[model samples]
Target: MEPFTIYEQQMQRKLTRWGIRLQKEPNLLERASKSIQNRINQVIPDKIHTTITATVKGIVQTTLFGITYMPKTDPLRGVSMADRDAKAEELLSLYKKIAAAEGAGTGAGGILLGLADFPILIGIKLKFLFELAHVYGYSTHDYRERLFILYVFQLAFSSAKKKPELLHTIKNWPAISQTFPPAADVMKQVNWLQLQQEYRDTIDFRKMLQLIPGIGAVVGAWANFGLLEELGVAGMNCYRMRNLQDKAAELADK
Candidate 1:
């Protein structure tokens, strides 16, 4: 099947699985416009970062709720690390393991038996990706779209014969372009710009980039551009509504 076909199929499946069936046009555009206007007054720049963090946290909770091996909170979930070197070393070791395991060739049709282990790694990767992208200058919309595109690339990689490490695949911008075209180019730009800015910092941002695909850099940069106060609210509210409906069914069964 064509890559675009695969993308559409994946999107369709995700939407359906999320119980998002629109019988007709929802008032999305109008709602979004109103949200931007109403919320901006309430969404002070000082509060922007916190709101964004909350929005992202909610999205993580909603999407990977039951995805096998994912985590409920990101690895950086609690506590601040005063020792930059120690924190950097820990992140590096974890990324190295993920890269090495993936590089060793997981093969096609591979599935993780461990669902509980996924959330932290995935969440940390996302958090790092968003921060990196922001330092380089991208919008939240760009970050989201790039993330969706990268997910598609990851799925396609599993279909191919090569046992590619996430770092190796991301490092090769040309190959990424084969999977995601112009999106890959945009990601490279974002990643490179961010790296230059953070080069002297004590943060192990580079290792973080090497963990996930470079697409995250694009997404993060994009997200940093503005306050995404309503980023995950709609989807989250939908997820909650679905959970409630399911509970209602269980009650009926009893």
Candidate 2:
């Protein structure tokens, strides 16, 4: 009956629908495409696969764990969910523009710059996630929190086949994460091969177009902008599910 209660209801419905969508089986076209990709991957040299896996793992680990690159952000303590959501929208708007600009710049430079966009775009996305985590009042200073950020990143960008399991894990992250004690090496838990392959498979088609000399700029900007848009929605909704579900559980206890 109350305004806050109604808002929570809306969020609950949204999260439920999103959960259902995440569980969708990959469609026919997707399966076919994946088959083709897999065939291609099988033919690629093992050394090349190893190199790519190593490169992606290095980039993620460096960006995620490097204290120097960590954004100086603090939790938005004691804020109402509505206020936090509004602030998150503002932050996402800023990041979207930054991504678009970077995409355009690199795309205009042709193949070399386009090739360079992988790490650069990933850096922007990671930075945005750090800021987003703070917006939702979560501190990334803890190992699990950084792991949470990575999970959210994968949720938004990983292959469709991986989505259902990822969604389930994220939904139960508070409990699932605890199985790993503080001393456990977070990096060791990650499936680095899955991480790199799914991420590459997810974005390869559109991102590859950005390497073209002529249309590269336009494609780059569009693709980068869309990436943020998807991530923005996922980030906000994932946080809402966690926050709202926790609050509900607390009320139930009371």
Candidate 3:
């Protein structure tokens, strides 16, 4: 096995700490916020709620199951971890810029354009995850692997109260993924309302600012940049955990 570089060691420590933090129960303020958010969701019209749910469901299915949406990068087979991470960093930087631009464009256009950012941003994030999977040498072509991507998304955007369970599932993904139904069945069973609610709650404050007339452009750009940055970190560490676990298992076998 290759010896861990100082950077790798530090990253491992940071990821470990993050995992611990993720497993902790939500505090009072977080619970209160979640309650408020849930109430807000309830007051939203049923038709609008259904539309959001359907949109999110469609996006998730298309992103994960679409055959034509092959990853841009080839799988990083035989690549060193350092090289893989370097490539991921480059991809993250590129996507952040793209997201910022998209946000700015929509934000400057007022409420209607601001609303359009939802699906566009979802596509960008899902595409980024697919590309990130390839960089980590994972085949996004597999249904189970794509499911892992969804789990990572959930981990990133879920409420604090929901994080522990999602984090646990992601941490034990290899086993948990096996329990999932077939792709079609899984899609049918997806809780789209929950998914959209959690996602909307997570970004509501910043995204609402993007709907404002005067400062919308700046807020949109900044919000999208930050959201992508968060996803980048989450994606990196999720793959890192899987890679490290696989390596350790291989070493144990030897």
All candidates: CA RMSD (Å): 21.6, 2.1, 1.6
Better of 2 and 3 by TM-score: 3
lDDT to native, each model:
0.32, 0.84, 0.87
Name the candidate that leads on TM-score. 3
For residue 175, model 2's alpha carbon misses the true position, in angstroms, by: 0.9
lDDT of 3 at 90: 98
* Cα lDDT of model 2 by residue, 124-233, tens digit: 88888888888888887876777788889999988788888889988998889788755247677789888888887878788989998899999999989999999999
Q: For each candidate, give its TM-score against the true structure.
A: 0.21, 0.93, 0.94
Poorest 10 consecutive residues of model 2 by lDDT? Answer: 1-10
For model 3 the TM-score comes to 0.94
How many residue pairs clash in all the candidates, one count each? 16, 0, 0
Cα RMSD for candidate 1? Answer: 21.6
Task: Estimate, for each residue in 208-231, the C-alpha lDDT of model 1 and write its tens digit.
Answer: 233344343332332221111111
